[model samples]
Structures are given as structure tokens and as C-alpha cells.
Target: MALAEPFEIARGVQTESETVIVELTHEGMTGVGAAAPSAHYGETTATVEAVLPRLFEVLPEDPHEIDAAHTAMDRVVNDNPAAKAAVDIAMHDLVAKLHNLPLYRYLGLDATETPTSSFTVGLAETGEMARKAEAAVEAGYEILKVKLGTDRDVEIIETLAETVPDARLRVDANEAWTPKEAIRTCRALDGLVEFVEQPVPAEHPTGMARVTEQSPLPIAADESLVAPADVPAVAEIADVANVKLMKCGGIRPAIATFHAARAHGLETMLGCMIESNASIAAGVQLAPLLDYADLDGSLLLADGADPFDGPPVPALDPTGVVGTGARRN
Candidate 1:
């Protein structure tokens, strides 16, 4: 899918997202999912496609046997979370449809307290980003996640704070800053932004801990926390656990990660890659479990670019839709 515009982060810029859509059929019903693989995570369209067939072979005949399916897939392969995520998501959609319940209701999550998702403003010139922030506010987004990595990160954010005074702001550096730089920037923007995300590289755990210790704003772990096993270390240094379906596998593993985060006393969040509603919809179903959300992947896509339709974003209310509410347009 083409982005509405170029979406830049610290790692680089993307103009289009190549996503693989997955469809699973059983007993005359079909469930849909998609894989929005990220090269940063060692996945691409080819990787996801290559691993899916082997993963599918392990899926249990019963869609309800999600645990067994996951176990079998893990035993078959090591770190193909995006591929596993597609199958995992499809199976979840199928099970919910068979039971005639919305995905969240099937999982027993309350819909009353779902958090509003943050619309992201990818990196751009200071003036351009400010314009985007103003447009997002005009479009009814009260919260915004501003991408920051440039040398003028502080200037960009300060301009945005002025551009949309009422908007709640969150900033993601996407592991762009050095430890000292992260700490300095975080302190500089303390009151202007909500929190800072992945300010330093994931490879430097000690540096991340140092930044976390010094930053005035709460820290959110994105690249630093990829799986449940990383939760304990993340909890020691970050205030929020940013869980993504692509990063941790899918709904089942994401749930496990969230539970582990909670047990370690960290705030839980759900983020997404630039994705279609096919996968983002599944993430929407789990919104009640989140303290914060950044599930604006479909919103960033060019209008009508996605082939599937799913739950509404920003509001992210999943009250009455059956299954994942994701299907072909």
C-alpha cells in the first residue's frame, strides 16, 4: 500500500508498504489476516511468504487449538514472528467467527475502556510536520505520535506543540539517539510531549538503561522489547511495554507479552507497522488490554489503497463486529 505521503522514521523512510494478505477457510467461512513485515526485524514480503507454508502445516484441524498450533509452529521454526503472526491472526479470526462473537468478546476483554489510538506524524521538515499535526487535529485526532530523529528534533516538536496546542503528543525516536542525546532531548521536551520511545539503540541495553534513568519523561520500550523474555529487562528500564503483533508473533503471544509486562509492573501499549486493516483489525480487538495505543497503520495508507476493511481506528471501538471485522473490500 502507498502511504498518504512519505513516512520517515529514524531508521529511514518508506513510501509504500508491501504487505502479504492471508486468508484461511474452514467449513464455508473465511478469516483474513496480513503480514506487514519490517526489514528492521529481519522480515520482508519474501521471508513471510517463504515461512508461511511450513507454519500452516502445523496448524491444528481445530481453530480452537491455538495453543497447540503455536507450539507446533515454534518447534518447526525459530524467529519468523511475522509469518507466524499471519497464521495466528487468521486462526483467531476463524475461531471468533465460529463462536459468532467479536474477537475481543471471545477473548473476554471489556470494550468500555479502550484507549484512543494515536495518529502518527512521520518525520519531515519542521514546517511540514507542523502542517501535518494541524491536519491531524482537524481530522479529529486528539493524540499524535510525532516521529523524531533529525538533528532538529527538539525544534520540530516545539513547533508542533505550538501548531496543535490541544493535541496530546507522543514522540518516537525509533532508536535514533545516543544515550546522552536521548537524555538531553527527553529532558528538553519533558512537558511538551507525553513520553519518549526507543530513544537509543536496542543493541545497547546498558545505554538504554542509562537514558531511562535520566530522562524526565517516561520511556517506552519498542525495539528493546521484542518478546516475553525481554519483558523483565525492559521493566527494569522502561515505563511502557510497546507490544506489536508483528514483533511478538500474534494475538496469543501478544497477550502473553502483555501479561508478563503487567506482572513486571510496566504499562502496556499496542503498536503496529504500516499495515492494512486485515492485521490492524486484529490488533484493534485487543485494545481493551492496552493503556496506550498507536494502531494507526491503515490511517497512514493512501485512501482506498488497502484491499480489506476492518474496525474503525482512532476511536477503535470493537463492540459489535463479529470475528475481526476484516474482509476484502
Candidate 2:
């Protein structure tokens, strides 16, 4: 799918990408899933397509072998979280549909307790970012996650905060800044933003800590926490943790990391790569555990062929997401 608007980060820019989508049918109960392989994580559509053939072999008709299918794929491959998430989410959808329950109900989460997700305002020229920020709020987003680290980071946030003062604004540098730049940037936009995410690169754990210490707003780690194994390190360093299913494999590991973050007294945000309804449905299943949410991938895509429809799954107001995880038309 093509991004309705360009999606840019410190690493590069994206306008379109080929994502892998899957359909796992059992007893005629078809479960759908989408996997958006991220170049940042060193994954490509070809790689995801290559790894998924193994699912047909190992996904026996246990019906509820969600964990087993994910595990089987992991044993065969090392680190294609997005690819594994495709099978992981389809199995979850299958389990829920087979039980005649919504995926959230199947997971036993209270729908009322799920937090509204934040809409993203991808990095752009200052004027364009302001317009997108305003548009997202007008579209019913209470929370907004703005991409930062450009020379105009301050200008962009200042413009957005001015445009939507009451709307909650958050900033992500996407590992673009240095320790000093992060601290200075956060200090400049302290009250303007709710938090600063991944202020520096994960490799610079020392820089992260220093930025965390100096920044007034809470500091969140995204690049630092990919797998559950990386949790302890991020927990020790940042005040908040961002968990993306694409980055961590799938639902089970994401939940494990969410609980792990809670145990470490860190705030959790369940985020996602730009995707379609299938994976967004799986990501939002853990909403009860998240302190923040950014599952706005499908909403960013450009048309009818995008394969996402309606609230909750595609969420009319992702900020007020509430529903089931089947293919909602």
C-alpha cells in the first residue's frame, strides 16, 4: 500500500511498500493477517514471503496453536519478527473466529479499559507537518505522535503545538539525535510534548541515560527494545518503552514484554509499522496493557484496495478504538 502522505524518519523516507498479507483457513473459518516488513529492521517483502512457506508445513490443525506456529517459525529462522507476526496474528484470528468471539474477548481484555491510539504526523517540511497535525486532530485523534530530528524539529513542534494546543503531542526522534541534541531538543519542547521517544541510538546506552536524565518529559525507548530480551536494558535506561509487534515477533512476546515493562515500572506503548487491518487488529489486542498507543498504520494507506474497513480493526477514530479483529467490512 502507498502512504496517503510520505512517511519519513531519520533513516529514510517511504511513500509505498509491498507488504505481505496472509489468510489461514481452518474448518472454513478464514483468518486474515498482514505483515509489513520494515527495511529499518533489515527485512523485505521478498524475505517475508520466503519465510512464510514454512507456516503451511508446521501449522497443524490444532486450531489454537497460535504459540506453536510462531515458535515453529522462530526455530527455523532467527529474526524476521514481521514475517513471524503474520502467522502469529492469523492464528489468533482463527482461534477467536472458531470460538465465535472477538479477538480482544478471546484474549480476555476489557474493551472499556483500552486506551485510544495516537495518530502519527510523519516528518515533513514545517508547513506540511502542521497541516497533517491539524488534519489528524480534526480526524478525531486526541493524541499525536510527531516525527522529529530534522533541523526544523523545534519549528515543527512549535507549529503543531500552536495548531493543536489542547491535543496531546508526542515526539519521536527515531534515533536521530545525539545525546546533547536530544537533551537540548527535549528541553526546548518540554511542555510541548508528552514524551521524547528514542532520543538517541540504542547502541549509545550511555547517551540514552544522559538524555533521560536531562529531559523534563518522560523518555521512551523504541530502537532499544526490539525483542523481549532487550527489555531489561531499556527498562534500566528509559522511563517508557515502545513495543511493536513487528519488532518483537508477535502477540505473545509483545504481551510478555508489556508485562515485563510493567514489572520494571516503565510505561508501555504498543506501536506498529505502517500496515493493514490484520496486524493492527493483533497489535491493539494488547491495548489493556498499554499506557499509550500508535496503531495507525492502515489509516495512513491510500485507497479501497488497502484491505482495511471500519472502526477498531481499521478504527474510524483510532483514538477511540473498540471492536473485534475479524475482516470487518
Which of the numbered candidates is closest to the native, going by highest lDDT?
Answer: 1
lDDT of 2 by residue, 243-296 (tens): 998899888789889889888889999888888776887776777777888888
TM accuracy, model 1: 0.99
Any idea what lDDT model 2 has? 0.81
What candidate 1 gets wrong by more than 4 Å, as runs, is: none
* Candidate 1 weakest ten by summed lDDT: 310-319
Which RMSD values do the candidates have, in order? 0.8, 2.4
Over the stretch 139-250, how does candidate 1's per-residue lDDT look in tens digits?
A: 9999999999999999998999999999999999999999999999999999999999999999988998999898889999999989889999999989999999999999
Candidate 1 pairs with clashing backbones:
none
